[model samples]
Target: MSALVDMNAKSGNLERALKLFEEMPKRVYRLSKFSGCSIATLLKVCKTTEHLHHLHARIIRKGLEQDQFLIAEFITLSNSLASLNYSSSVFDRVISPNIFLWNSLIRGYCQKRCFQDVLSVFIRLKRQACLPDNYTFPSLIKACSSLCNVEGGKSIHGSVVRHGFEACVFVGTSLIDMYGKCGHIDDARKVFDEMTERNVVSWTAMVVGYVTVGDVVEAKKLFDAMPQRNVASWNAMIQGFVKLGDLSSARGIFDSMPEKNVVSFTTMIDGYAKSGDMVSARFLFDQSLDKDLVAWSALISGYVQNGQPNAALNFFLEMESMNVKPDEFILVSLMSACSQLGSLELAQWIDSYVSKSSINIQQDHVIAALVDMNAKSGNMERALKWFEEMPKRDLVSYCSMIQGLSIHGQGAEAIRLFNRMLTEGLVPDEVAFTIILTACSHAGLVDEGWHYFRSMKHKFCISPSPDHYACMVDLLSRSGHVKAAHDLIKSMPVEPHAGAWGALLGACKLYSDSDLAEIVANRLFELEPRNAANYVLLSNIYAAAERWIDVSLVRNKMRERGVRKIPGCSQI
Candidate 1:
């Protein structure tokens, strides 16, 4: 019976193994090594943490606690579940752990991104006189890199040398990665230079290190010097060029490659998308015989980002037809397009698809994204419904709803929501403050706008940006305090932006001031020479002031500068 259970467990048939164990006589596990080992193996395949705990207790009660091999398996299983505390408990119960067992526990901590825990294990490993092997150093050094502890990394490096594993290839690559990520490219390069041998991975890590430091020139030099190259090495170099906004150089490498992988194509597509050349992006995407989720997402996002919502929708439809399942990224991109178009039908469809799928409904950003989509698409009622329906509303959700309210002339409600955010202990970020201030400007609440502007710096410690100043100027100018707005712009500690000047100039137009209009127009002409609206506005101000000669001069200046007013339409 025990043999059959072990066989079932080994084959990943945990149900069959458990059934056989349940049917076995009492004290069977205590008397047989096969029973304990089989249950331990079942824990490896089992998904439930509760079941594992039950089996763990059984293992201890059965007096198999001294079985280091079975205990190591339990630690490995617990680690995979991200149950580090459980793994540690199992590790502690073991009388004395072997080197493999120690590595297993450390590996668990590394997987959980608990770098400090991994470091603590290394210290314990040393005190216990169990010297770290090649398997141990790689995980430890990686944790050091993740933590960016250069000093800790150096101590581990000395330990690696003392343990005679310095020449280990895998360990060498890890050291290079550790030092590189720690921002010590010099140390990384020195390690790379001293290496007895180098693989493509080692070469790639070094190149990536140089890229991280923004020394793409040196990275390219290293790339050229490599004896052999893999696709990753090529991708690393290409990404380096793209990072520096050198698309031409990145394309040159892309074309030179003998073989192009998905990542290679995706990188080039992303570059073209960012550069506003959607033509190249689509051309490459269509040419691909195999389009993965990432490739599809890159093209879809490119269209959305470049302001082609219809094109983004078309690609998403094509992706759906291909039976290519969309992840959260693609869903977000689709939602962004839907939000821009304000298509309630399409928004409902996305919501339905999300509901039908097993995607985590608890994901805060996804839920907030849906709200943003509805708000932007001119469906505030539906947006509010979704916002209320959300079980876990994050700060973004609050800000989006507030901005939406302000857009629909519910300024008082937006202020109330902002208060609610503070009451909930949610700190407003720069973007949130910008929205709230814009809301005040839209609602013509000059005093309220001023109060919040002061509060942003004094209470929240967030200094007002140019956008905030622009909002204040807009608020003051809109409330018939045009001269006061102009004075405020002049008194600004930071250099007033074109928006500030534009707001003031707009107020000049509101009050029909020929002299102030002339002053503001010249500044606009210097700041935005191509903006024909400024010239037209100045001409209008001259005409409003009954200065025919000045109006003609402004028109002649506009023609000389090749500036033409944007076409306007009249409602019948």
Candidate 2:
């Protein structure tokens, strides 16, 4: 039975092994019949916390609780299966732990991103007089790096020197990485310079460190000076140039590389996408032999960002036809494209696909995109349902819901939700204030609008942007405050944007104030020379007042400027 259990566990058949283990006692074969290797195999193949607990109890009943090797293996495996607390509880009961046991627990903590606990354990190790080996400082330094605890990292570096492990190549590389990540690139370089020997990783760490600090010049110098180069080093240089918006330079490095991988292609593609060069982005994407999900996402989003929503959807179809499952990011991009197109049919298809697919509906970003898509598609009820179903409402989700309400002219509900967001302790940013102010304009909430507007710069210290000014103008105009709206536009500290003028002009048309309409229209003509709506609005204003000659002049202005009115379309 013991051999059968071992065989089943080794074959990755947890159900059979667990069933056989449960039947072991009835067969008169105790757990002692299982070797430590056999027991370790069971630990490795544990399917759940329940199975782990049952196995642990059996190991304890067999008097192997203090078996150091078995306990170490359990802690390591538990890092992946159970929680770190389980590993901590198991570690606490060990009477005399060797260095291997200490390192295992520290490694588990590091893996779980419990950086402060790693420091706590290292402190305890010092008090216990257990000498740390070369394996010790790497995880400890990594903990410090993750926490950005440069002081702690420096202290650990001193200990590494005292323990004579500073000369170890692996330890030196970790120190270099730690210093680099912590924005102490000079210190990283110093460590690299002092090292008697360095590997490709050590050199790459230094290059990446320089890239992190935006010192691509020095990074390129180091890249040129390296005795050898790997794909990581090449990718780092490409990323540096791409970040600085120097796509030409990035492409230059990419073209010079002897080898190119998915990362290299993805970085360059993203650069071209951001620079609005979708032709180059698509060209590179098609040229790459290895197209991963990230590469596909980059190209799809690039098309969407470059104002090619149909292209994004088409590529998404291509990816699906090729058997590539879309992840959350790609799904979010698709939702954005559908929202841009304002296609209720496409939005419904995306919603249905999400329901039938493996994507997590509970994911916050995916849910947020779904909310936006449904709202833009004119399905407010579905948008509200998703908003209320969010497991945890983040600021982005709140903004999405509030904007949905604003666009649907449910301004009162938008204001209520904005207040709810405040009550829940989310401080509104510039984007939130802009959306809320637009809601006020749409719903004609003047006093509430001014209150939030003043609070933006006075209470939250967020200066009102041009969009805020435009919303305020629209709000006053909608309320028959034409003179007040014009005054506000004139007093704007920043240059009044075309939106502010457009709002006031709209009011002129509404009130048939042709004189002020002509003035606002002339300014808009200078600002947006090719805007057919501005010329048409001005012409309509003149026509409404029976000024036939002035209306002809406005139409002639459109002809002179060669501005053509785009025919409008309606969704079914």
Candidate 3:
């Protein structure tokens, strides 16, 4: 029986080992002696949480829960569980855990982005006087990076130096990453430069750090100078170029690479998608080999980004038919496509799947996508419900819900949600303010709009960005405050953009202010002379005020400038 259990464990045949355990005679074999190893092996075979719990109960029945090795194995298994709350409970029960057990919990917390918990565990480890070795710093550093805790990370770095693990490859890489992520790019660079021996991971970490901070030029420079380049290095540089809106550079690198892997292909595809060159992206996607989930997601996201949500849906269907299992990313991408396409039926189907499957869609980003999808699909009620259901909501979700409500002419509801978001202590970004202001404009909430606009800087500490300014201009202009809107634009710290002038011009036309209209028209022409719409709009305003001479003058100028109005074309 012992030989059979050992063979099954070695071969990873947990079922056979379980059957052997059950069939063994109690009188001949001592069950207590080998229960820990057998239970660990059994837990590995159980894939679902339910089965894991069942096996855990069996381990308790065998009185193996107190064994240190068995507890370590259980921690490892819990770490593999995707749901944070479920695994967190298992981690809480481990009695007097060792270094391995602590590391397992830290890794799990890092995976779940439970940074506070990770820090708590690190603090507890310190209190226990558990001198951390090389294995300790990576997860600790990862937690600090996730939390953007530069001070905590620096303290950990001090500990690493004191413990003499600063030179360790994994520890060094993680420290570099932590500094880079904490907005200390120079420190990140210093760490990278000081490393006596750099591995692929260290190089990749540096490149990724540059990319994260939008320093694509530095990232590219490092990519060129690296002595060794792996798939991750190539992916990092390609993704960096993509993020910088250098699609051409990204494609150049993609072509110049000695080898292309799935990540590299996905990066290029996403680049083309984001740049609105879906045709090229689709061409490359079709030519690629072994389309994995990322490849499929890239294509789906490309279609959604390019406003061809139906195409994205079709590709998703094709991917399903090809037997490629959809991951969280794929589902989120598809959900976004469905929302953009206004396919409420599809969004409903996805919602059902998310509930039925054990997928962790509680991530704030994913929930944002879901909310955006539901709202864009004209299901504002469901969108609001989903927003309310989110376990951890962020500003993006709130902004999305507000925008959805505004689009559906439910500005009051949007304002309510925005208030709720503020009450919940989430810092509203400029985009969130813009959406709320737009909602006020749509609902004709002039007083509310002005209050929110002022509060943007005074109360929220969010300075008005270009989009925010645009929204304010639109609000004032639409509410018949054309002069006020013009004054606001002139008072802006930065130069008002073409859209700002365009908004004032729209208001001038509304209020029949030919003098202001002409001034705005001239400014618009200088800013965007090729915009035939601006000339036409100014001409229409003159015609409305019965200023035939001015209308004729505007028309003559448009003709003399050879600025032809683009023919409007619509596709069904």
Candidate 4:
């Protein structure tokens, strides 16, 4: 009967194996005498959480709960099935866990990105005097790297050296990656230099370390010096140059590569798109044979970035026609294009498609884009519904919703939401502050604007940036406090930007203060001589006061500077 269970389990017929195992005790078979291999096989074939618990109960009944191998495999399988809590519970049942059990728990936590938990488990492992082996440090160091906890990584490195595992290439490679990711490239280099044995991964880690710190020059030198290079190493070098906006250099390397994968093609496409060289981006995109979702996303994102929303949408259609599924990333890019175009028809189609296709629109990024798109398309009701229904409102979602409210001139409501975000313990960043300040300016909330502005510097310790100052200037100017706005601009610690002057000049036109307008316009003319709007604005201010001569003079100056007023057009 035990052999039958083993054969059935090994053959992947878990249902049959489970039935036989359950009938064993009812048929007077000795459960205690069941072979460990058969039991291990049964555990391997177990699919659902219910079955796992049932087997665990049987193991406990048979007094095999403490079987180290069985418990270790149980813990591992539980984690693999996304049951970290269950894995932890099983580990807790072991009265005397060996190093293997401790390592298993640590690895599970690391896989789940529970970095602090990994560290906590390591501390417990030490308290129990369970010696960690080479398998332990890689995951443990990776947790530190993911957290960017250099101090924690350094402590782990000390442990690795103490355990005499530094010479192990795998441990050394992890240490190098940790130091590199933590912005300690020099320390990473030190680890790389000390390693007596190095493999492709070790060298790749060092190469990537240089790339992360924006040292592409040094990275290239190392790349050239490598005894051999893999596709990842090549990709890293290209990515470095692309980030630096050295597309020509990136292309040179791309053309030189003996092999080019999808990542290689996608990286170049992204670079060209960002540089506004959409033509070249499409050329490389077409050159790639393997067009995965990532590659398609790259092209679509590039079109969006290049202000070609229609092109992006058409490509999305092409993707669908090819039977390629769209993920959250592509959806976000498409939504951004819709936001820019403000096409209600397009927005509705996308919303309906997402619903019918069963895409997970509730993902934070996707929902954030949806909120922004709906608001931009003049569908505030749906936008607000989506915002309110979010299972978790992260900072990005809050910012998007707040910006949408600001766009609709619902300043008071935006402020309320901002306060709600504060109550939720989401510390507002600089961008959040800028949005709220702009919201206050638009609503003409003078007192509230002053309060948040001072709070930014005093309470939040966030220094008021130029954008914040510009918001305040516009707020004061709109409230008929032109002199106060001018005084604030003069008192600015940083050099006053054109936005501050522009706001005051616009206010001058409202109040018909020709002298102040002339002064602000002259300053702007000096700062932004090629800005036709400044000249046109000054001309309007002079013309308002019936100063035709000055208007003519402004026009003459524009003619002299050869500045042409660029006509504005609306996008449907």
Candidate 5:
């Protein structure tokens, strides 16, 4: 009977094995090491815990629980399911775990992103007098990459050399990847150079490394030099072009691919949308015959990002009619669209769906999106309701709260939250400072604005970007110090964007300073020739100053440039 079970299980007839086990008297079956190993193999194919438990019990009943091979197999299966705790429990049961067992446990922990645990396991592996292998170094180095511990990874690189596997092609590829992910591109380059044998994976890893560091020029150069190219290498190049916003290059390669996968089309769609070419984006979407969930998500997200939120929502409805299950990306995209439309009813519907979602959107992320949706839709009270109920808060939650408060003219409240963020040790990033600065500027709190502005560089070490400078200019200008704002623009280390000059021009219009407005307008025109707002702002300033002749000249320039004001939009 045990032989029959082993034969059936080994032959991939698990159902027959299971039926045979059930039909036999439980105590009558005497299973051997091979039969136990066969059941363990069957455990690999079992998806449900119920069958797994039955097999586990059968193994113990047959007194084969101490089979080292079977135990190792159990550990591998646990990790494959991402149940690292189960792997650990199985490892604890191993009376004499060899190097292979240690490596398996470490690899599983690495997959869980428990980098510290991976290191701890490595230390334990060494203490057990088991020499780490080439397989071991790759997993350990990956953990170092995940932790961004280049120093630790370099030390592991030393171990690879000590073990005489430094020149090994597979280990070399893993090293290049690890260094690249850890932000050590130079180190990655050094390894790539010394390798006497380079495969497609090694070259691709180098390309991806350059891409990850925002050095697309280097990535492209390396990509062009590869002796042979695989689809993955081509995809890496496509990704590099997308990151560089060279949509033309990305599309060119995408067009030339011998074969296209779902990832290829989705990346192109996302690239076009990011570059603000919605027409091209939709053309690609309509052409895709196999619109997988990710492809659908890319199109849907593109519409919302390009500000056609209503169109995005309508298309989502169409997707639903096709029975395509919505993922978290689609749900979040819908939330943003509903928020932009300020349809509280729709936002409310999404909230219900979130609670019932089988996909398990992280609690904090879902709550943050809900809060942002409500806040953007002009439902501050409801926004507060979800925000206050959040179990925890992250950077996005804080940013959305401050931005929502600023947009609603709750400047005081926004500043209060910012101070609270500081008190809680939540170091504000660039976006956080921009939101608070805009809030202070909007509220006309010049003194507080100046304090925060100076603190941005002096205290926070955040060098003010153009957006921050614009907020400061607007703040000073709004407070009746147009001259100070102009001087500040002159003092800017970086070139002022149109927003800064536009703010200064608006202030000049308020004070009827046509002379200063004329100077600023010319710069604005030169900086952003096609921006109608600048032309309109300059004309308005001239009119306020009773400079009809200057206003006429501005109108002529707008006509020559064929610039027209965008139609106004009002939230219903």
Candidate 6:
């Protein structure tokens, strides 16, 4: 019976082993001798924490807890509890844990993102004279990587080499992942190159490392050079291409693959959706043979991203009709869709379902989505209600409320919210400033816009991006200050983009300033010659000033360039 249990445990057939253990006749010597491995296997088979506790009590009643092997097994079970971030009662009960027990706890803490606790436990283990083995460094490195602690990671790397496990494949892979995550891509590459043998995981680690750092070109180059490609390798490359906004290239690769798995399909669908090519995504969705939860989530997210919130909601209904349970990710996507479509009724229904179902929607992303939805639905009162209800508030939630207020022309309210964000000790980011600047621009608050733009660099230490410059130009131009706007453009530290030039041109037409209008037209033509609107703008300016000859000359240039202006019309 003991041998059968051992074999079943090794083979991961815990159910059959547990049944046999229950049916075995009660024998004192047999229970004493086999209780350690039996409890270990039972714990492995146990689906719930209650079952694990019950088995632990049985082990103690049989005096198996005193056995060194049983004690190690108990520590392993405690580590499992830590994996779920549950109570530490099992850890408290362990008498004198071995090196394996200490390593298990460290690994569990690392997995739970308790990096500081992992380090403290490591210190305690060293004080107890339990020298860390090969298993020790991987979890330690993983903790450092999660914490972005470069110095701690390097110290662990030194310890790895000292222990003669630097060449171990698992250790090397963890080191590569650690360095890459810590922004030491060059060091990761060095480790990859120096390793004599490389597996799929090693290659995937490097590829994903480059992808994480936004080095898509390098990721693609390495991906193509790989001798073998697995599902993860393909998924990594597809995800990398998606990040670069090269959905066409991602599709090309997806189409060329010998096997079209669920992940590949989902990645391509998401890529198309992100690029605003929902037509292609829906076509693929219809043709897919196997649709899983991830595929549904990706499609729903795509709809939300493309501003078709109604379609996203309809799909969510379809997903439920098909008996697919909605996870937190799906709920978040659905909530965002509700917000985009301004479907307050649907948002309320989702909120109610979240509470009743006890779904773990505790993430800031979900809370922010709810806030944004309420704001979009023109329910600022409800939006604030949800905002205040969040267990933990992050920058995204603050930005969402600010954006909602700005969009509704409540510039003062938006600024007030921004002030509140500052009062809460949360530093504003580029998006936060962008929202405030937009509110100022829409409210015709030119001075406020300027102050915020300057504060972006001086107060927040964030450099003014092109979006900020564009907003400032709109604020200046809309106030009938075309020449001032032009001078601001000229004084800009960076070259003005097409959007900035276009904003100035629109203002020129509004104020009928022929001199500045002509300058803006010329700049627009230089930037985008194929834009028929530029020639049309110049012709209109000529006609308005009664310069028939100049207008005729502009029309001739338009004819020669094969530029045809799109006809303006109103639907309603």
The numbered model that scores best in lDDT is: 2
Could you give candidate 5's per-residue lDDT for residues 1-572 as a string of tens digits? 76787678777777788878767665554646556656665776766656666776776677766776776776777776636876797687777787777887987888778899999999888787788888898888888888888998899899899989988898999899998887789999999999999999999999999989989889989988999888888898899899889999999989998888777888888898777787888898888777888878887888888899988988899998999899888888889888788786787777787778786655666778888998876678878888878888777888888888888889999888888888878888888888888999999989889999999899989999999999999999998899999999999999999899989988898888889998999999999999999999888878877889988999999999999889899999
Error of 4 at 412 (Å): 8.0
Give one digit per residue, the lDDT tens place, for model 4 in 376-495. 887778888988988998887888888878888899998999999999999888999999999999999999999999999799999998889999999999999999999999899998
| Candidate that beats the other on lDDT, 2 or 5, i.e. the better one | 2
Provide the lowest-lDDT 10-residue window in model 3. Answer: 26-35
lDDT of 2 by residue, 91-194 (tens): 88998788899999999999999999999999999999999999999999999999999999999999999999978999999999999999998899999999
Q: In each prediction, how many residue pairs overlap at the backbone (N, C-alpha, C within less than 3 A)?
A: 1, 0, 0, 0, 0, 0
Best-to-worst order by lDDT is: 2, 4, 1, 5, 3, 6
lDDT of 4: 0.89
Candidate achieving the largest TM-score: 2
Candidate 2 at 363: error in angstroms? 2.4
lDDT of 1 by residue, 10-38 (tens): 78777787778778887676565767666
Write model 3 residue lDDT over 1-572, tens digit each, in one string: 76786678567776677678667676543456566666666766666676567666776666666576677677778777546676656656767767877787777887777888888888998898877789988988988898889999999999999999978988999999999887799999988998887998899999999999999999989988998999888888888888889988888888888988877877787788778888898898887895677778888888877888888888888987887778888888888878776777888887787767666778877778889988977788889888888997877777878888898899999888889988999988777787898899899888999899999889978778777787889889999999889888888988788988898898898899989999899999999988999999999999999999999999999999999888989996
Report the Cα lDDT for residue 545, model 2: 99
Q: After superposition, how far is residue 460 of candidate 1 from its true place, in Å?
A: 5.6
Q: Estimate each model's TM-score.
A: 0.82, 0.84, 0.64, 0.78, 0.72, 0.68
Clashing pairs in 3: none
State the C-alpha lDDT per candidate.
0.86, 0.91, 0.83, 0.89, 0.84, 0.81
Which pairs of residues collide in model 1? 342-377
* Candidate 6 lDDT tens digits, 95-148: 766777677677777767788888888888878877788888888888889889
